[model samples]
Target: MTSSQIQVPAQEEGGATILEIGQQPDAWREVGGETDEGLARFLRGITERPGLRVILTGAGSSAFIGQIAAPALRRHLGCRVEPIATTDIVAAPRDHLEPDTPTLMVSFGRSGNSPESLATTALADELVTDIWHLVYTCDRTGELGRAHRDRANSRVVYLPERTNDTGFAMTSSLTSMLLSCLLTLGPAGRGNVEALAQAAEHVATLQPDIRALAQSGPQRIVYLGSGALAGLAQESALKLLELTAGVVVTYFDSPLGFRHGPKSVLDGCTLVVVYVSNDPYTRRYDLDIVAELRAQLSPDAVRVLSCEPIPQELGTATVLPGLAHLDDAQAALPYLVFAQYLALFTALEHGKTPDNPFPSGEVSRVVQGVTIHPISPSDLEAR
Candidate 1:
C-alpha cells in the first residue's frame, strides 16, 4: 500500500499524485525548452515603455511561487517587482495599484480556474489605465489562460499539457509553471535553458531514496529555510498537509526565526526538514539550527535539504543532485521534488489517498466558496 511497495503509474493506489510528482523533471524540461512568442512580444513592449511595474500575484501555492521568484526577478529586471496575493488585491485593490503607472501583472496559477486569479486580473484591468497582463498557467483551457490568450496587450505562457495535473495536490503543475515563467521572462532564459532543463532531469534519481526516507513515520513535520527557500518550505508544509488530509500537523519557518519560538514543537514524533541555503553566510545559520535541533531532539528528528552537499558540520542531508549549479530560484524547480515525494509516500504510509487526499469531500481540487466582493470607492476611502 505504501509508495515504495507499488510500481508507479499503476493508478491503483496514490498513482495520480505519484505519477505527477515523478514526472516533474520531464515537465520542467518540456516547458523550459519551448520558445514563447507571447513572452517575447511582452518583452518588446516593455522596452518601449518606462516605469512599468511588474506585480506577481497568485493564490495559495501559486502565490508562494511568486514570493520565491520576486527577489531574483527584481535584481534581473532592475524595476519595481511586487508579489501580492490575489486575495489581497480583491479585498483592497486601491492600496496596491497606481492608476498612471503602466503595470504588467504576472499571474501564476496551476488550474487558472481559481476565482481569485481571474477576479484580480479583471479588477486590475478596470483599475489601471496603461496596463499589460502576463499569465503563467498549466491549464491553457482554464479561464485565466483562455480569457486573454488572444488579447493585444496581454501575454499568456501556457505550460505543456502533461504538467496540467489531475491530482488534488499540484506537483508538476506548480513547478512547471514556476520554471516556465522564470525561463521565459527572466534573464539567460535563452542560453541557459538546456542546462536548467538537465538539472531537473538529473534530480529524478533521488526519488527512491527520498521515498524510503519519507516512510519513517513521523507524525509532526516542520520545514525550514531562508530567503526564497522559505517560501518553498511553506509550500512543502502545505503539500504534506493536503496529501495527508491534515492528519500530519505541519509547520514551516526560516532557520533564524525557528529558534525564536517555533523550536518548541519538536518531539520524538517530529521530523524537522531544514532547507539549507547555498550562500555561505546563510548556510552557516541553517547549519547552526540543524546542529542545535539535532543536539536537543533525537538525532533522527532533524534532516537537512539542499542542492549542495551537506557541510560536514550539518551532518546527514537529502541532496537534490546538480541543482547547486543553478541559482536558488532556478534550483527550486528540482528541490521541489524531494518534499513532494515525502508528502506522497507519507500519505500512503498513513493510509490516505494521495490523489483525492480528502475522501470526506471536505476539500476539492480547485478551491471553492471564496466570493470576491466588489471594492466600492467609499470602501477604499474608509481604509
Candidate 2:
C-alpha cells in the first residue's frame, strides 16, 4: 500500500505525517480539556494507594513499552516498579507476582485482545489481593477493556480513536501509549510532555531520509542503547523484523555489552543504529562503542547511523535532529519515530505492503495462540 493509504487524520502539507499516528504528542494537550477529570481521577486513585508495587505488562511492542517506563516510573513515583512481559507472566507466573504485594498492574495493548494480554490480566486477578488494574488499550470494546469495566479496582483508558491504527504494525498506538505512560508515571516536572510532542512533530517531517536508509538494503540492522532505552533497542530490532517479514535479520544490545561478542555481528552490509543517552556518564560508554566501531571500520564495511549526533570522531551518520538533554523517554520518541519509518520503508523495499507486511497471516496485529493457566495458592504466597 502507498503511504497515502495510511495517511494520518491531522495530515498537514508540511507537518510530520508519520509521527501523527498513535495519539500525536500534540493530542495529549487535549487530554485535560477532553478527559481531564478521568485522567485526574485515574492518577489520584493510583497515587493514593500506599505501598503499591506497580507492574507494567504487555506483549511484543507492548511489553517494550513497560521496559521503557519501568526505571522512569521508579525514579518519578518513588514506588517499586517492574516491567514484566505477559508472555513470561503466562509461562511463569510465580517469578513475577506476589500475593502479599498490593499491586497496581498497568497493561498496554494496541487491540486489547491478544491472548497473552487477556491471560496476563486474568492471572493478576486470580493471584493478587487488592488488585488495581489500569488498562491502556487502543480498542475500546476489546476483551481486556470490557472485562475490566464496572469491576471494582479496575479502570480502562481507551486511546483516542485516531490512535487505533489499522496497519499491521503499530506506529501511532505505540507512541500514544508511551506518552500516556510517561505522563502518568515519569518525572513530570523535568519537562513538559507537550514540548516532547512538538518534537515528535518535528521528527515526523524527516520520514523520507529515515525511510531511505532502510531501503538501502543493509543486510543486518543493529540497534544499541543503554538504561531504559535498552528495551527500546530490542523493540526496534523486533519492529524491523516484523515489518520486513523477517527479510532483515536484526540484533540489539547495550552499547557496552556489544563489545564482548556481539560486535562480531557487524559487517559491510550491516546498518548500526545507536540510541545515545544524554547523560554525560552514560553517553561516555555509548560514545566509546561508536569510536571503537569507527576505529575498526573497513572501507564499505558497515553503515552506522547514530540516532543523535555525537562528536565528529565517532564517524556515523546522525539521523534525527538532536533533542537538548530531554528526559530519556522523551528523547527516545524521535529515535523511535525514525525506526518506524525505516521499518515501513524496508517493507516497501521488499515489494511488500508497508501497511500489511504479512499477508499470509503468519503474524498479526493482535497476537494469537496462547493459554492462560490458573495461579496456585503457593504462587500467591510468593508474589
Worst 10 residues of 2 by lDDT: 9-18
Query: Tens-digit lDDT track for model 1 on 1-383?
Result: 54346455643356778778777765666666688575687676784477878899998889988878877788778888888999888877888877889898999888899999999989888889988888888886899999889898788887887788888888888888788777766653645555655655655676666667678778899999888788889999999999988999999999999888887888888999888777777788888888889988866788777777876765777666555655677767667777888888888888887888777789988889988787667775744
Q: Point to the candidate with the largest TM-score.
A: 1
How does each model score on lDDT?
0.80, 0.73
> How would you encode candidate 2's per-residue C-alpha lDDT over 251-363 as one tens digit per residue?
99999899899989888788777777767788889877776766676423334434356677656555444465466766676567667777766766776655556778788
Best by lDDT: 1
Backbone atom clashes (below 3 Å) for every candidate: 0, 5
For residue 43, give model 2's deviation from the true position in Å: 3.7
For each candidate in turn, give its C-alpha RMSD to the true structure in angstroms: 3.6, 4.3
Question: What's the lDDT for candidate 2?
Answer: 0.73
> Scored by Cα lDDT, where does model 1 land?
0.80
lDDT of 2 at 191: 49
Alpha-carbon runs more than 4 Å astray in model 1: 1-12, 188-203
TM-score of 1: 0.92
